[model samples]
Target: MDPLHDLTSHDLRVRHAMEYEYRRGTNPSVAAININQAYPKAVSERTCQRWWKRWQEEGVDVEDKERPGFQSKVDNEELRDLIEMNPRFSSEEIGEILGVDSSTIRRHLKAIGKKYVSSVWVPHDLTPQQKAKRVNTCKDLLSLQDSDPFIRWMVTGDEKLIYYVNDSKKSEWRSPGQRPVGRPRPDFRQQKVMLSVWWDKSGIIHWELLEVGATISAEVYCQQLTRLREKLKENRKSLVNHWGVNFHQDNAPSHTAKMTQNLLKDFGWKIIPHPPYSPDIAPSDYYLFRSMQHFLDGKKFKNREEVEVAVKEFFGLKEKNWFAEGIEKLPNKWREVIELDGDYIIN
Candidate 1:
């Protein structure tokens, strides 16, 4: 071998110096120190010991031998094209196509910034027209808000299923080697009741816990609206007399039915336009129900009355500002919908 000083490759110099040190019966630690002094971080003592052991057991070679395996070569362009064509393809699937090991495929995919993530489920695969409508509606709402600032007077309502049992898997503190606590799988047939609730910036105005298995129809929804109006008269008399009611509800079949519309007109409430498949912008869906779920977590109710008590407790715990904050998010959500070109707001 050429003199270590004459070796052009830094790796070759390190190997050659290790070999020289082995020939001279120098210890690996000393050999590593000498090599690092010469080349600065050329190799660690452990690496020198490994090379010395290899040379003593097998042989010495200044250059690295080809690693013994089927060398996997991935064509990055081909891999990228395959992923672009079908992002859902698994590492094993791509490996089969590329004639490489799945592990190799995973490493390469990671190198190219590919990550396996579950697809986010959207409310709808909106058509271009639907997207345009969402954008236009949001813009109009923003305009209405700027002119009227009527969100404070707006009353929003929606129905949610209140499960009798709301247990969920949760993490627990345990000894390191101990197995995690297990939870039973969720029961799809668990008893639940429909909770129809209406609220404004002030707080909940009206709420009802329907009987088990009762679903809202157009007639039922219209009756609920009448009840909601009566509640508003009792609780929010000032809002009804001064600002009137700016009602907001999703475009459910019952909510959009002719009877429902006629009832709203008779009550003289201004119906705020809510685009279809837009729970992201709805105060009840995004804010109120989300907080209620947190409150209901791990709770169990034996009867409808127990569930009703829990619901009332949840509502009563929230202050007036909390309800106001929920309604306050509407204009910003509307702006976001327009800014995102009608894409659902992730947060």
Candidate 2:
């Protein structure tokens, strides 16, 4: 390649040398050899000098090498959809499916808005009905928010169990310079015992330590309601004065028990209309208890006592606003679920 192709400051010196030699009228062979190390015969001294001056004026980087090869593996759109499908997949796994290197996957992902967020279970494919339900639920929740807003009189609560087995596998470092090891433990929910957690904007005022887990009995659920009433009474001087005490629970058989229904009617606790088989509508399902489960992951407690403490600590640390935020979402969601004719997804 002719050195003049670059037209750098150094090339200017060569050009000037060639010109001086040309003017001196040296042997054509010697002149050609001298120029051969720098420029071609077709390159005039003036042109070389101009290019050299341009290079000196504007210090530019070497142009990058040509792109090396064809793209391997998945297309950008396909990779994006797959990432959207499941955020938990690492680049290596994505590459394997797409038939490309992990680096290719990483490049594609970075191009989109996806960041290396904590692994998320990007939900499984939902049916058309499922997607519609979810969207409608949001609409209802928003409507509910607009109607009542907040008065502190209306408090919502739900009961759930925090299991003993650490239901989550976590990455830990045993030594330096080694890749962190993740405990790949499947979700081991100990259905034998469950904690009944019910809290409002105030805090976790009532909870039940359930001995039976598989299917909650009507009597057991009624007992939970009874305890919940008693606990709420303890918080306030008179249940009568707090007239807005709305007992919100799902259609667990016990909640719909003949005796329990009578008791709620007698107590004058407003029963928020709860839809059947609707775990999505519950705040505990969406916001509050997810944190509790996450904390319980990768932890082990042999006895009920240790499990109780962990459960207590988990709820105790949550901010008051977090609970309120969940409750606040309910009214609008309820209105929406009702409007969708009972077919809205609540997440």
The top-ranked prediction according to TM-score is 1
How much is 343 displaced in model 2, in angstroms? 4.6
Clashing pairs in 2: 133-344, 133-345, 134-345, 140-332, 140-333, 140-336, 141-332, 141-333, 144-331, 144-332
Tens digit per residue, CA lDDT, model 2, 1-347: 11211233344445456456545665445654666565444344444344344445664222211224524545778877776444445565566566665555655665663444223222333355654665565564456546854325554555554545554543332211122343443233342356677777666768767664444566766677777777787885444374457566655555678988887887787765544446557666666666776888777777677877887788778787877777776665566655666553433
RMSD (CA, Å), candidate 1 to true, equals 15.2
TM-score of 2: 0.51
lDDT value for candidate 1? 0.76
Instruction: State the TM-score for model 1.
Output: 0.63
lDDT (C-alpha, whole model) for all candidates? 0.76, 0.56
Ten residues in a row with the worst lDDT in model 1?
A: 1-10
Model 2: residue 103 alpha-carbon error in angstroms: 29
